[model samples]
Target chain A: MPVNSTHYLFLSLLLFSIGIMGALMRRNAIIILMCIELMLNATNLLLVAFSKIYADADAQLFVFFIMVVAAAEVAVGLAIIVMMYRKVHSVDINILNRLKH
Target chain B: MAIYDILFWVLSAIAVGCALGVILSRNPVNSVMFLIITFFAISGHYVLMNAQFLAIVNVIVYAGAIMVLFLFVIMLMNLNADVEPQKGQLVQLAGVISGGVFFLVILAAIKSAKPELMDKTSTNIGLISDLGKVLFTKYVLPFEISSVLFLSAMIGAVVIGKKEETKPLTHNGEEE
Candidate 1:
C-alpha cells in the first residue's frame, strides 16, 4: 500500500511536539535555536506531504521560501547569540536579565 | 506493506527518535548532531513524497550549512552541560506537560477533520522543472522578495557581529 498523507501529517506532528518540548525545557540558547529549526523542518515535511496529496506544486514552492527565510533567520540569530555570549559570558537564557528594571 | 510504506515508517521513526535525542542530550554539540540526524530523516521523507528537489535542498541547507553553523557556535561559546545551568524540575515538567497537551489537541483535530484525498494520477509536479515553472511564474514576487530578505539578514548579521572600538582616554596635561 502507498503511504497516505495522514501518515506524513502524524509524523510532522510528532516532530513538531518534540521541538516544542525542547524549546521550552532547554535553557541553553543554542539548543533552543536547534529546536526551532526542528519545528521548521517539521512544517516543511507537512508542506511537502500536502503538495503530494493535492497534486500541486504550490506547497513545495512555499517550502522553498521557508528554507530561504530559515537560512536568513539562522544567520541573524546565531550572530545575536554570539553577541549575547560576548556581553554576558554565558549562553544560558536565564543569564539575560539586564532587560529587567 | 509496500516498499514506500515501509520506508516511510522507518524514516519517521528515526526522525522522531533523533528529535527526542535533540532535546534530551545534555551537551549542545550532541544536540546539534541529533538535529542533523533529524534533518536527514526528514529529507528521506521528502524523497518518499516524490519531492526530489526539496530532499536535496533539505540536506544541503539544513544538514550541511545550518547544522555546521550551529556546531561552530557551540564550539565558539564552549558550551557544555557543566557550564550551562539547568532549569528547575518543575519548569521542565510543565514544559513536558504543555507540549504533550498540544500534541494531543492537534492529533484529535486531525482525526476529526477529514481531508479530501486526491487521486494518484501522476507525481510530475514535484519534479524540478515543474516546481521552477510554478515558482517563477505565479510566485515570482515572493521569490524576489525573499532574496531581499536574505540580503538584509546578511547586512544585519555583519553589523551585529562587528567588534566595537574602544575610545582612548587622555589624562590631565598628558596621556596616561
Candidate 2:
C-alpha cells in the first residue's frame, strides 16, 4: 500500500489537538507558549500537505510568512514573559486569575 | 510499502510521541526538550513531503532559534521538577476528559477526510529556486506585510522589555 497524504494530515490534527489541550490546561505560561508553537507547526504541516496535493507553491510562501510571524511573536511573547516574571516572581499562569474578571 | 514510507511513519510516530510528551511532562525543561523532538520530526515530515527548503528552514528556525530561546528562559527561570504544583483530582480529571474529547473529535475528523494522492512524482521538489520565485511573484504582498508585522513587534517587544522607572513609594506605602 502507498503512504497517503491523509495519514500525515491526520497526525497533524492529532498533534494540534494535544497542543490545544496543553495550552488550555497547563498552569505554566511557558508550556502554554510551547503548546501554541505546536499548534502553529500543526497548521504548517497542513499547509505543506495541501500544497503538495494541489501542486501549488503559494502555500509554501504562506509557510514562510508564518515563520516570520512566529519569530516576531516569540520575540514579543518572551519579553512579556520576562516582564511578568519580574513582577510576579513566578510563571504560574494559574495565578493570573486577575484577568478573569 | 517502500523504505521511504516506512521511514516517514517512524519519524512521524516519534514526532507525535514527543508532542504528546510535551503536554504530559510535568517538568517545563522536559517539555521544551520534547518540543525540540517535535520540531525535528516536523522537519522530517517536510522532507518527506518534498519541501526540502521548508524542512531545512523548519530545523533552522523552530529547532535551532526558537528552541534555544525556550531553553534559555527555562534555565533563567530556574524551574525545578519539584516546584510543579499538584492539581486537585477533580481538576486533573476535567483536563483529561476535555483533552480526550478533543483528541477523539479530531481523530474522527481525520477518519472522515478524503485521501488525495499526487499524480506526477517529482524529485528535488521546492528547491530554493522554486521558493524564491513563488515568494516574490505570487505571495509578495503577504510577505511584505509579515515583514512590517515583525518590525512592529520588534519595537513593541523593546518597549515591553524596558525596565520601568518606579517612583519612590508614598507615605501610604503606594507608588507615587
Candidate 3:
C-alpha cells in the first residue's frame, strides 16, 4: 500500500492524541506548552498534506498564518510563565489554583 | 513510488516518536530538544509534499527560532529532571484513555471517508513565487494585519515580562 492522505491523516491524529495526553499528564507549565506546540505541529502537517493533495495555495497560506499566531502565543505564554515563576518560584500548574489568593 | 512511501514512513515515524519523547522526558530542556526534532521531521513531511517554502519556513521559524526560545527559557530557569513535575498515575491514565478514545473515533470516521478524498489534482501550488504572489496580492490586508499582531505580541511579551516598578530599585553605587 502506498502512502496516501489517509495515512497522513492517521499520523496527524495520532500525534495530536499524544499531545493531548502530554498536556493532560504533565504538571509543569513549560511541558504543557510544549505539548500544545506538538498539537499545533500535528495540525500543520495535516494542513500541508491537504494543500498538496488539492494543490491549493490557500491552505498553505493558512499554515503560514498559523505559524505566525503560534509564535506570538509562545512568546506571551513564556513571559507569563516567567512572571509566574518569579512570583511563585515554580512552573507547576497546581500553584496557579492559589493565584486568587 | 516505493521511495515516496519509505520517506513518508520515516518522516512520520520520527515525528511521532520524538513527540512521544517530548512528553515522556522528565526535563524541560529534553522536551525542548525532542520538540525540535519533531518539528524537523514535520518539515521533512512538508518537503515530501512539495511544500518547499513551507518546509524551509517551518525549519527557520519553528526549529531555529521558537525552539531556541524555548530552550533559553528552560535554561534560564535551570530546569532539570530533578525539578520536573508530573500528574498522578490515575489522572495520567484517564488522560491517555480519553485521548485514545478520541483517536479511535476519528480513525473510524476517516476510514469510512477516505476514498472520496484521494483523487484531487496536485500542482506547484507550494512554490515560493506562487505563495508570495498570493500573499501580497490576494492576502495583502491580512498580511499587513499580521504585522500589527506581531507588534502587539512583542509589546505584550515585554510588558508581561517586565519587572514591576511599584517597588523602587535602589542604586548600589552613588549617582553621578
After superposition, which runs of candidate 3 have C-alpha atoms over 4 Å from their true positions?
A: A99-101, B116-122, B168-176
Q: Score the docking of each candidate (DockQ).
A: 0.73, 0.68, 0.72
**Tens digits of per-residue lDDT for model 3, A1-101:** 87778888899999999999898888999889989999998999889888887777999999999999999999999999999998788999988886486
TM-score of chain B of each: 0.89, 0.86, 0.89
Q: Cα lDDT of model 1 overall? A: 0.87
Worst 10 residues of 2 chain A by lDDT: A1-10
lDDT of predicted model 2: 0.84
- TM-score for all predictions? 0.93, 0.91, 0.93
Report the lDDT tens digits of candidate 3 across residue range B1-176.
67878988898889889999988888778888889999999999888888999999999999999988888888888886557656889998998998899889888889875542433345678899999999999999999999999999999999999998675546865321
The Cα error of candidate 3 at residue B87, in Å, is 1.4
lDDT of 1 at A66: 93
Q: In model 1 chain B, which range of ten residues has the least summed lDDT?
A: B167-176
Report the C-alpha lDDT of model 2 over B10-31, residue by residue, as the tens digit. Answer: 9888988999899889888889
Q: Which parts of model 2 have CA positions greater than 4 angstroms off? A: B123-125, B167-173
Q: Which digits, one per residue and each the tens of the lDDT, describe model 1 over residues B4-87?
A: 778878998899998999999888888888889889998888877788999999999999999999988988877754567889
Better of 2 and 3 by TM-score: 3
Model with the higher lDDT, candidate 1 or 3: 3
Q: Say which docking band candidate 2 falls in.
A: medium
